[model samples]
Target: MPNQNDSDSNIHALLIGIDNYSSTSLFKSLEGAVRDINLVEAFLKNTLKLPTERIRRLIAPNREDTVLLVARSAHEPEPTYENIVKAFTELTEAAQPGEQIYIHYSGHGGRATTIYSDLKGEGQSDEGIVPMDIGQPDGRYLRDVELATLLKRMTDKGLVVTVILDSCHSGGTTRGDYAIRSSGETDTAIRPRESLVGSREELINNWRSLTEGIHRTAWIPVSRDYVVLAACRPTESAYEYSVNGKERHGALTYWMLDTLNTLPGTLTYKALHDRVGAKIQSKFPSQLPMLLGEGDRAIFGTNRISTHYTVTVLQVNASQQRVKLNAGLANGLDSGTRFAIFPFNTADFANKQKQVAIVEVTDIEASSATARVLAEVEGGIGVKGQIEPGAPALLLAAPTDLVRRVRFHDQKQLGEAENELPTQALVDQQKEALDAVRQALAGNGWVMEVQPGEEGHYQVALGKNGEYEICIGMPIKNLNPPLMFRDAAAPREVVQRLVHLTKYQSVQELDNPASELMDALEFILLDQNKQPFPNPSNITLKHGTKAYLRVKNTASQALNVAVLDLEPTWQISQIPLRGNNAAFYELAPQETADIPLRFTAPEGAAYQQAKEMLKLFATRGAADFRWLRLPPLDHVIEKQHEATRGIQSAFGKLLEAVGTEPNAAPVMTRAAVYEPDPNADWVTKQIQVTIVPESLLPD
Candidate 1:
């Protein structure tokens, strides 16, 4: 782990928190923003032992509230548009090379019409933080473009920066008991004179110069010098809730502080993010924290990478031996899922000695679960004392009945005549290959040999020489060409291909008919002119024609959405916002997003019609569905590993279970057990479209 003490002098911070606004009707006063900054300041001074002079504070406190514990300093300036800009300028000019800067903001985020449409590329709106002076003559938002420009100035000077935003870009209304941290959408446009630093023309020219050579349609420019820890997705709301049953605080800020206090000076930003996300989702299932840019870097140091996913132990009942976890059906927990309890600070679960106990899920709710302790280690090495709240429960295993059934076809089944039989040695080789494959799959929990009377999901037929052909069923008549392997293919290689096929099948078969989100989401296919296609289920478009997909969220809650393109060549890839570096497309309640689509025939084929499927996935909380992506069958078989972030280990293990290869050690952190959250109420909707040659069009 990197030592923070060695670089304490090089660290500086700027904390901005706003709870009051000039336009009260437009932006409601928050109860937690002022307190958030106070807590952060306390951490820096008391915990990190940083000098007071190294930290700068700007705040807008509610004047009528006397219950706020932390008294605002008179010297601290309000977080108005001008003061905020001046602070950024001062920090950039004063900070030395190689120093670290931490910027934290807790306020309302808003969206408005973009002032420079040409510079914004395809986006017509700009998202920004609403300053305290907004609604006044000179009041305006500090837009994302302007913020990126400011951060670039700091990074260009060789300084490492980290930004924490406890606000969201969309969603305005409160949900249940939580108050949203958003100012809603605005039609007010920002003028060129509103540039933070330079004149309008200079800022535009500088922004254009900075974005030169980069993808022009990107909503926000990508940068590696800094990382942003956002409270929620762009489509969702950031809430201020009573975290401790007393005072309110931004959910992200509270959980983040809790993680830091428990495991201070020992985590990278990525690890911190994972821990914080788990905790926040436990209470606010609708909010998912986002980590953008250089997530692998150390908290305040230059570079590092590691992550671990675990549910928090919210409570323990000694008499009943039942512990409640901060995860439930919404987090993908089931009745039989098991976990190994570890200390909150345990970074590596590979160390078996650090385990405290083993537990199994007994009951589940929408956002929480109850588990019973099955066994306690004789001695807890890492975490002393008994199990308590906030302990990390690493996934041990999940009980699942999902299996891949395969039927192997003999030469007769392939329609070969007996007189064409090869030499006796060739028959022996074929038998040897079948036995090798069966043996390799024997221990796999996910793959099973089809019984005599049982149906199989896949049929594998051995070729005349030594090649193999795999398809969905026995005949393989009209379906796309069978996934073929060359002669002399190794049994292990063949098994890996089967594993990939299993993954492809599993993703396609994913469904949640009982989910409320299923009805909340609507997927529409559009033609060249952006009009809805008449027959969406049986769509046909000329090759290379302009197409579009519009996703609308009609539910009261926000959703994190993504579009996966299942190509005719049997490859699955994410389509929407591709190459734009967006984490996922967020659709606010009753909001819609449009994604452009283009279809073309396979290479070297002049006139052909191919079928393609588009799958849209939406969840109340954030879920990484990138695990569903697979390379085309014709493409070379390269080993692809899922990201080690959230439920990746769970997904990886599913693939690993049906293979003969030894389990690979995690890259930086131990593998997390995969628990599919049904409570996230995830839903998938797919559309099939047929692409035809342009010459086939009727005059």
Candidate 2:
């Protein structure tokens, strides 16, 4: 890694944080922006040892509270539009070639109508950061277009830059007690044309000159000179919640600093972003942090730490010989999950000599887990010491008999009238059906039944219509309608559907933290005309429109690739491999594979528009993902093909064990049936597509 001590003088930072807005009614005051700035400034000054003279801060502190005030001169300006632009200009002029620049912005973000005529036809609103003086007559936002141009000026001077925006551009309202980081308005009045940094024509001309006529109609040029770390997606809200049980701070900033403080060594931008994202999602699942542009580069162009699939030890309990980890149910951790502990500074965990101990999970929370040490190495006077906090725990083995919990609710009784109770025959029939369901799931290793109030992956209710209704265990806004199955459906068949639903949820959460191929694999979505979609997340496809997937293997080695379509109607099917008899298609290094796809809406008027996801799994070897495949919930299961005879690979056996019949044992001993290959790795990427009825399309 590039030594921070070696280039302390060459680093320049511009930190902008706004907490006290001029328009309190229009834009709510924030409690975290100034605090975020203070945390980041301390990280730079104390951790990186950067000189005070090289750091510049523009802050709008709350006048009421003197406790959280940061020491600054009276001449220091607030983070107004003009002052922010001037800061960029000063940094560009003062920084020499090959020097690094760090920019951090924490404030309200808003979306407004575009002022430029050329961008009006794009049908997308402009996103910008709200200045502290946004309510003033001459105040205006620093639009993304203008911000891109400013960053381009610095990048054009051969300077490296990294920007962190702890604000979101949409969904302004508060969720529960968490305060959102948006202006809470999307009106055209927010676009201050008169207060723009430069004339529209001048800004467009500068963009054109910088890009050398390429992407001429593009509003924001895709540049490799800088990396942007955004708090959340455009449609999601960035939140300011209480951190460490006291002070409020941006969720992204808090986790980013935590990861940096606990990091064993230097990490690349992509790895750092991934770690921060995992931590943030455990608390705020809706807010997904994004890494854009030049993610392959190391932080500040420093040497990079390779990715490792390991969980950090947060606390050590010497009395119980147990330790707390930073991952739990949210991260798919379960009891009996085994991990191989390594020293805090061990670079390569694959080396057996660096192993410090072995532990198994005993207790779990939403975001944390506790594990008891089963064995440890004897090094009292020798080389490596005992286990400690900040150590990395690499997953070795999970429980072979994993079960997906489902809460079963019998709502049929509520439909019966008080005076018109059902007959004994009817009651007996319902009892028989319930007994069948219990028998079907009795010993199935995949799914288990829970009471109404217990935590589960899905909720299954017997409706008055004599059909089983299944919905997500924790339903949020805008989820698809509940899946229904007729009363005549076989009990085993319902069990199969539940298993498939659990598998789908698992596949969505599957990730390899140690995989080196973070951004190397690309899954591009192409429209009917074979044109690539500009934004895959927002893609909308009408019924009968033929789509395609272009999988690019940018990694250095060949990989076995499989794509599974998770339909809106609750079906998981793999796209067949063209002209390949093998279970998975192998794509050579630097190769691309184009596969045709067809997405149709579910057969129901209620499903006018639904969202589906295409999950792509790339592995170093052939791993049979066929175990994840299933027909729609209403479809009857048919014995189409049998499992391949003879020996099975470790992954294949693992899947086989998961899909075992109910007649098999309910639990298995921890006698290692098969030890997973430590070096074997895989990565998964998913792209969501919206399926709409053809009638909804404009002529």
Candidate 3:
């Protein structure tokens, strides 16, 4: 066994194992409960090195046949509801903040239900654990909700607790049944008709689950503190099997202790879970152990990663913009660590959260590090007027309007003779076309001028894209025909769409970080408590509670932020501003916009829309969606094409009326560029968040 080596530590454990039940009860005897408990005790006492005195045991009464009898001392609590509750109460009173604790349960687990008709939103009777003496009404089963209530007390006291359950409820085990396939979860327990060892002449049995009434729903507590290791999903039953030369034990319990003994204090909760789960599934193939809990916690109270520490407020060098953290090397941290600051005091694990700013460690001492802010998440439109209703940010006059300067690249010369006038007249005609296109765009707020690479932030480039007209249907077919935008694709709109697509794709290639211009900006989604999901791609929701979207701005300039989401059904919609106020955000420099993302719907309807992929676009200036008033992307592109064609036609007739070559070849303009912002540039990023269904949540 690996040694933990920590002799002086404030850690406590409660280990419960019950192998016996009243003969009158519906449950059968189990052969592995005592074995599982004994092995776990060895793991804590011999391997992890917790003192035997700190380990509390609630086991079945001792008998001569027990194989691990030598491991237990004479003085120990017997498995009883009163004793178990008493241990919890005492721990609640004695445990302190930052104290570590372990809770393990190995025993008969059968589903039971208790009526609470008065409770609101209570759908059915709750699932429970079958306790010893469950045959009597006075010895009620320990229910899931009741257990959650008990666990809540420990969490409320701020003690870090880890729970391991190697048993299943909804009682039926098949250890002694006719041979069957072990491909998936099935009951495997020691259930025999009861017969007294001495005086009882007849073996009789009454099922506990049969009398208790099985419930369709299990009421596990909603908590974030207790790290959990459940034996199997609620849909499946846990099993006890013989392995390693006739050794009998609960599958999960055996694998768990084996891993802990091997890795000891060095294994993390996550790492331990992965190794244990893999072993259980590989050997049993039918059973799957589950790991549920907090982020990056280490096993046996060692090497804890503290992500919750506060920033040191002192600014030793204001010009350098350096800061420090409250924690340092002593807190398992070192230099070069990056920290994200949340504007709010709390974090919600289920909401779409935003980040305020990013800071990196520059120098480290024994307890703290010096950090400098790299960039601010800022998007300000610089519009002074009061914002109209439902728009999150004010719309300033566009940057292109402000710069009134554009660089026009005419690639039309690359096209065929039919695309231009006769060769003799083509030079003058092409020059005239360039002038005409340039003047048309300038009339729409672009002045054909740029200082080398500056380009005034917006450039008008056009060319004949025969590909646009050749052998292709609409690129966006999902849009309704009314919004299909069937007209010729405009030079400005087509160019703008291509530019937007390029920028959007750049941010998505996260592996190539350099391709992103606004890599420093982050939009976070969080649960109600302001804690992020362990897996952002697979978010778990709690009863349709509200989620939050936090924006972290580290840049020095303001910005306009717009978040668009694609539903699981492929519908595209923008995440509206708080209270339908604005379409975009005019965020201040080095500021954060923390808004509760309440999708405008009835309470029930919101939870149904949890599966989504969100695209958050941040621009140096506002990109107004209100003017577009478009539907999904499929329709948006089509309509933009239609509008571009309209503008081109108007410009084409104007060129003819304004006196060009008296009679010239028809101009085949292939593309258009929309000058979205003349004053500023924009960047885009997208992330997928999948909210797991409530029915599937273990707790």
Candidate 4:
């Protein structure tokens, strides 16, 4: 959208093709020369819709032009070095302003080396194409000066000409810096490389003398108006490929036509070359295309008159917004392709707010498809990677439907043992946790479903948090049930605090203009006035700035939650607070906890950047999930860490909890009685914080 087109109106083309050359200097004949010209000519006539008389060709066997019905003029000459030059001069002289000229050459080409002469100059000799009817040792060297001079003359007439040479060329332009090695070499450039009869240095000088107003040392063709698209880089070979059974094509020519015809709209010359180059690399990995002269010129003097979207809005509703898009299974735009509605018309792209409304496609039709507007806010959040949720990631297997919802369940505890917690008490704790989380994440198009008593697409489990294999969160997962039921202020305050936190989360929307913040923690940033910041991409704060972090639980069940700080060096330690009583806290279901952050945004060269990470983890049942290898419960004394225990320690005296034993006997471990559960759902996510760049800071 940030570009424009500048190309001519009228077109004039001179195409040359040679399958067989008479000179021994040509070395070998090409099988696809004529075929390549035929395909290229057809494309110009059909796809470009160019008039036939404006396009002329000179090929071997002296045949009449089939693409143009008009008979050839007496002035039209054969594709000899002399005739090619004459036709080129005529076009340049006659072409008026706003006209485009095309010169396409497909035939024998080679690097000229003077092996027969005793005078050996530098090995750096340029390449040339072999013209017909030359039997002498000198043959016909189509020097770069002739091409460069005529091209300059053409452009002087205010004509935008493009030259596509499908023949061999050496010591020209390069694709640059990328490392590439010759996969292998093939002498398929119509003509084979061979030494000539004269000295290389003298031949280059003689050709340079014919061109005026151009300065260069090398014998390579140079042009500014005549944008040149060479077959390959200076070091590579251009190949002819056999498609299907027998029909052949010059690989570069085939892809060039294929891309131009398939792309829906006109592109700048640079864009077209990029597409063609990519296609050529896919088919022949080693062959790199060369681009010389102007890259920003419009392709064939055509422009996309107006902006177009493959899909358009059809209808809008409270529940969902429907869109009609031409992209389908064939176009390869599958479900989940996001659509956006900007605050202002796209024509004023710079003035519009980024993504005022966003949607994810849910269904497809034959030619058009439908998508659901997932979330919408006034100013809206920037698309994924900025503030919005990115595409969902599925691990292990793909979901049945592309769009999936959240599912919740309390962790299933299997056996019985130790001084266990009551089933009712634990279940009540989990219910409270789930209720809190459910309220916090209310309006972001989240679809919540009760866990299937069986396996399904639902992710994010509510079991004791930090189960090692999944995600970990805050503390208070394991405590005496008596404390929760007590009248103490600390115990009652936890519930009230959770309720207030949920209120904040419930009202939070991504579009609020005041929201802009980042801190190394899984929490929301609230300013001194207690309003949420906008844009989580970067955070800025000065000396007196007051900020608060609201860390919320992801699961429905209560878990022992711990907040630890991870330094840039990967060392882990608890984030010490002056008033917090314990190393970890009992995080109630969906409870939102607050941590006040105090610091100044680093300034000047002394300390330009600073980063800190707070990791939240929760584990149910156990005093500590032994596998974590963290320090002992910091609030308690007697300190050697304990061994990992099983479900016996997690569940109390409810034998019916496992099953109503029909034998009236508690379920016992038996090798034959295998109640096998292969997998369970859990969740994990990452949060990052970055400092605003100095240049982007507020004035």
State which candidate has the highest lDDT: 1
Q: Model 3 off-target regions past 4 Å?
A: 1-8, 61-64, 68-74, 120-123, 176-219, 302-612, 615-699
lDDT of 1 by residue, 241-316 (tens): 8877878899889888887786645666656665676566546556767666676676767656454545666566
Per-residue accuracy of model 3 over 1-699 as CA lDDT, tens digit each: 222433236678888887766443366666677778888887677655678778888777335545555555677776666677777777777777767778888876654433332331344444555556655545655655456666766776778888888887543446552111111222222222221111112101111211121211122532335567777655556777786657668887887776665442344454455445545544443444555554246566634442221332222243434543433332223344555433322222122143344456667543334566555422422122221101111111122223234444444454355343224433333343444434334322213355676734343332232212100122322222221112343334433333333223322331212322365476787765777868876655543456666667677766656565544323344553321223344455676655554322112332353455566666543233322122332233221111100111000000000012224586667688554321124455666664444665675
Q: Rank the candidates by lDDT, best first.
A: 1, 2, 3, 4
TM-score of each: 0.63, 0.52, 0.42, 0.38
Candidate maximizing TM-score: 1
Q: Model 3 misses residue 275 by how many Å? A: 1.5
Error of 2 at 635 (Å): 47
lDDT of 2 by residue, 564-602 (tens): 777766666565433222234557788776666666676
Error of 2 at 628 (Å): 16
Q: Judged by lDDT relative to the true structure, which candidate is superior, 2 or 4?
A: 2
10 residues in a row with least lDDT, candidate 2: 649-658
lDDT of 1 at 81: 89
- The reply for model 4, stretches above 4 Å from the true place, is 1-9, 61-76, 113-124, 134-138, 170-223, 302-699
- TM-score quality measure for candidate 3: 0.42
Q: Global lDDT for candidate 4?
A: 0.43
